[model samples]
Target chain A: MHFHKYEKIWLIFGSGSLIVFLMVLGFAAFWKGTHPQSHIETIDPQNIEAHEAFQAENLGLHEVEDGKYIVNIVASAFNYDLGKDENGDIVKTIRVPKGSSVLFQITTRDVVHGFQVAGTNVNMMVEPGHISRFETVLKNNGEFTIVCNEYCGIGHHLMFGTVEVY
Target chain B: MSTKQLTFSKQESTLYMVFMHVTFVSLLIGGLMGLLQTLVRSGKYTLPFNIDYYTILTVHGVILGLVLTTFFIIGFQFSLLGKTVGISKKQLRAAWLSFWVMLVGTVMAAITILIGEASVLFTFYAPLQAHPAFYFGLAFVIIGSWIAAITNFRQLYVWKKANKGQKSPLLAFMVTINMAMWVIASLGVATAVLIQFIPWSLGYAETINVLLTRTLFWYFGHPLVYFWLLPAYMAWYAIIPKIIGGKLFSDSLARLAFILLLMFSIPVGFHHQLTEPGIDPTWKFIQVVLTFMVIIPSLMTAFSIFATFEITGRRKGYRGVFGWFRKLPWKDVRFLAPFIGMLAFIPGGAGGIINASHQMNSLIHNTIWVTGHFHLTAATTVILTFFGIAYWLIPHLTGRTLTAKLNRLGILQTIIWTVGMTIMSTSMHIQGLLGGPRRSNFSEYAGGEQVATWINYQLAQAIGGSILFIGIILMVYIFIQLAFFAPRGHEEYPIAEEESDALPTPKVLENWYLWVGLTIALILFAYTIPVIDIIKHSPPGSVPFSWPIGRS
Candidate 1:
């Protein structure tokens, strides 16, 4: 076999690659060695029993400080409604005091239901035996809509819940 | 070995060249649009360009996902299939038709999206309606692809009938896997458009569920990526060996890899919908489990393919398990592309495994992390494979030797691209973990610095993206040179290189392991589908459930 002149070029490229790989490897090692992982916080969905529920009527808004609160949530295939309203209309409202922190623990009885609190910046993963925690501060007072981001079967578009902040 | 009998006809070679031209053109178009999106979003380009972000995103997705992958696979498959099944010019014409139909579909889709008609991700995330033309154009593209698949299947069946009882060629196996996945997977999207979206858009159906639409859409979406990936794997298996001057490590291992790709890639679509409403937690868990199962085959390929490189490297005068790396031809794009492309599986495989994990997926889902993950695999593993393939094919197609200068440029482009994308994607993954959403036009915090880390990562991504854009431009220039001025038939290929060896068959290939493996995989699939239906169809008042406060 004849000696190829481009052999030197190949060697240079290989060496350059090696140096780049070393730099990346060093950066990764340093990053992994320094950063701390965010720990998972928890909340429950059964503790909001017979509390004075401030109904936000619409897909109302809410603000809660960084803490945990159990939200009683019921899921049906067609629509989701909170227990009851002042005039006795079935309303979905979980009112937490302003400046208090909470994680609205939610779940469903039938098909999967989506618990999305719109406009309040607290969206989470809701599942059974898994309290989807939304950790945030109640910096302002307002209402937010808890629209389901998940499609719970055919009537998914109509699956709505409400939250009111007092 | 007669030189006269060994060469492909002019028409066959022209078809191959056309496919390469289309792929490279689509790559440049997609890459430029993607760069524009990155620049505008990163605030680097404040120019008064009226290019819509959604339009550019749509072009990028459709062009990359549909055009580049389709052209590369069809082009490569044509050549390989000739060796596998004795390809004819008539079949080549059918392949060309597929390309034209796809080209029209792409143009229509681009027009529809650019004019603010259809802003949906090519997945066409539903209840979020786009123009009727977008869906109609998409239909034409799918139909064309289906025709292409049928043509391929017909040829393979013909070959099988003629060569009764022989195992399919490894190239044939990879193409078959991709074709099978495409035919099976496209049904979901086709059904969505036919039964749900089409009627809804046409005013025939009053109301349609977005959840159901999404479920079906991702069903097609996830497997489509595999369709793109398998062709790349084909090159890795078949061509990389010859280029590296080594034999395939294990024929049976390669067959198993294809079988696993077909089996696991389809049922794991729910992983994409993990955060979406409707699917049960238990169901999501099952999807996650199956997604992880895909990793086994991927790792198997990685091991087997890398081992081939090691053996080749050793034969070329390197010592030690790692020493083989030193002997590799780093400046030969024909050699370097596949080599670097294969190593890309490191991040691609790791990211895929992370996405497949249930708890971990929640952290990265819909975040810039997801974007990073796909870029690692799609851009690096698959697209880079195409780059390598172009070099491998140029001599055969153009009948000319690719210039050494162009060869050097191709290698430089591949390296710059690999390094630039790695840094960009790695940073995106970090930002994603910090809750940076993917596909957002312009994300802003309420005040001072809530997502500072994410912001910094995006900034770094912008810098890396600029470097990547330059590399892309260099590639386009090299391809043009290869097409126009490269001397025809300058490097004569030995006719012996075209024939297969009747060597000692690997135990895996000699047996019907793939059939048995598939049968077992089907059983696992059966167990999961029922769970999916149960969770999906449960009555609203069926069972009382609540979120658990904490886990042990």
Candidate 2:
């Protein structure tokens, strides 16, 4: 019911810090549009192949609009791929033109996975049946490795894909 | 009532001793695994017996995080309840039952991990399922704890009925609330394990809703960290002040923190799932607010503890900007270890706020930064505080006095732990920011040019891990010396005086149902919609078994 003067001061101060923090976070997420895969996109995990964008030709890259590309990927078992990992299943090396607004729309075929572009802001948990889409523009010409940061299975360590921007 | 001594009964002492030994053994194994994990990641060596990185990571998390902390907290609480409430022999039986059940559960889970069937890490999200035995074993561990909670509750109920509205003994009140929070919060994981994983592992369920299961996991996961933390808080509240020759800054404040914990701990778990899909940003933001609310109590702890030190120091004639800190007992490992641990939490707790932020979570989620944040709070704060408690506890339980040499070694060990954690956690944060992911065998990325950039931090982690391993060995040495070789003397329970001006702590602090009801409501409101939505739209789980695990 009662408290120390110092304790009261600190509590108010700490709560202020918390409020300030949540305010900035709120601003970034809402105003600045730096949210996570919050407004999510979904898929039927049992039938990844049947998904429209996941069709063989559409797997690697599809133009959602003029000059904007969506890299549709199925992150599963290990590597981030266009559809699935199997014998001769190539880990997609996405070559994007510099300054392209690339939307990475990815989901897992089997287990929980993470799609993280090394040295970039594109990171989202790739869960089965739940598509995680994040849009970013590759401004510079460079190669960025897309690694699965989540532990899917034993092969999680070997799981990676590439984005070669030119 | 300023008596300097409080004693434990023979049975009470035995319970404490046995559990403390369990803590020691579990710590040794877990600590070794932690070091080796970093080494293997640094590409220096490989695990023997077909063992792999994930297996070691799983064991490292389980033994250290779950087994050691649970065993120690139960033991510590029993000793406290025994001294404070005078547990009947009947009550002691319930306590013993809890201990043995937990031990069996731990063994079962450990065997599963060793045999390579339960390499599912501590989070064990479904579809990447473990053996049925692993799920059952962990269930036992949780049930064992629930049984132990019953004992705590039983003691409190008996005490309260007799005392008739008198404020419960401070330690009992805090421990009871801590246990109550655990019991309430663990329901999420308990449900996931029982209704989902166990059946799935046994082939009863054809598939699981992965999002639904992960939702359930994070629901319990965040609160589980508090379960590790609150005992160390109990220690800080009651014991640390006395060791520093001070009194608790405020008993009511201490009571309020625990009460607030019961209110806010469980409802905010959604913050852990901020990056995962199938959870709405609105719900995530709401939980972020709740997560931030939890920070208030911790800040109270920081303020209360610092106030206690200042008052104590001023009384002893230390003054000026930081002279009071200088006057405090720096050489006393009992105070020193936990003090540094507390300091580490400031940055750790700050990092937690970032992780909870819907926007900022993007920067560090799934990276080793999250791993670093955990080590700072749970690993250092809780683990170091436990080390501090052991300095007195092992000797007290073993009927021996802590010798000067043991204290000296303990001081050295504590310093090593702080330095090692500093190197390890800081490097982990930098590397994670630099895009090094955790929980994988990075050796699989060995010498790839991009991976090559991570090499130095990886080397730092190995160095840090080796230093930490040395600290663990010294801690064991100190424990053995205190428990078996130190000379006999009486040990006193450290109970700091509630600052005398403080009114008797509000009796409402002792009210359990009101807080528990609110907590349940909060959890339901926070989790129900998201969980239902996940299950509604979720794809059926895939069968992961037919696939070879790694390098196939």
Top-DockQ structure, candidate number = 2
For residues B244-346, could you state the per-residue lDDT of candidate 1 as single tens digits?
6777666656776777777788777777765543355555656665666666677666666766778678777888768987777677788788777788778
- Interface RMSD, every prediction, one decimal place: 12.5, 2.0
Query: Top lDDT: which candidate number?
Result: 2
DockQ of 2: 0.62
**Best candidate, TM-score:** 2
Tens-digit lDDT track of model 2 for B1-552: 122234677878888788999999998999999999989978887878778788889999999989998999988887777767668778889988999899999999999888778777888865676778898999999999998999988987887788675677788888898898888878888998899888888898887777777777778888889988999999888899899988877778888899888888888887888878778887888888888888888988888788888888998899897788898899988999999889999889888878887767778888899899999999899999999999988887888887788888889999999999999999999988888888878644523566777777888999999999999999988888887888998655677767666667666766677878888888888878877777776665666452323321
Per-model DockQ = 0.06, 0.62
Q: How close is candidate 1 to the true structure, as a TM-score?
A: 0.76
For model 1, what is the error of residue B25's alpha carbon versus the real structure, in angstroms, after optimal superposition? Answer: 1.7
Please give the distance, in angstroms, between residue A63's alpha carbon in candidate 2 and its true position after superposition.
4.0
At residue B87, candidate 1 shows an lDDT of 66
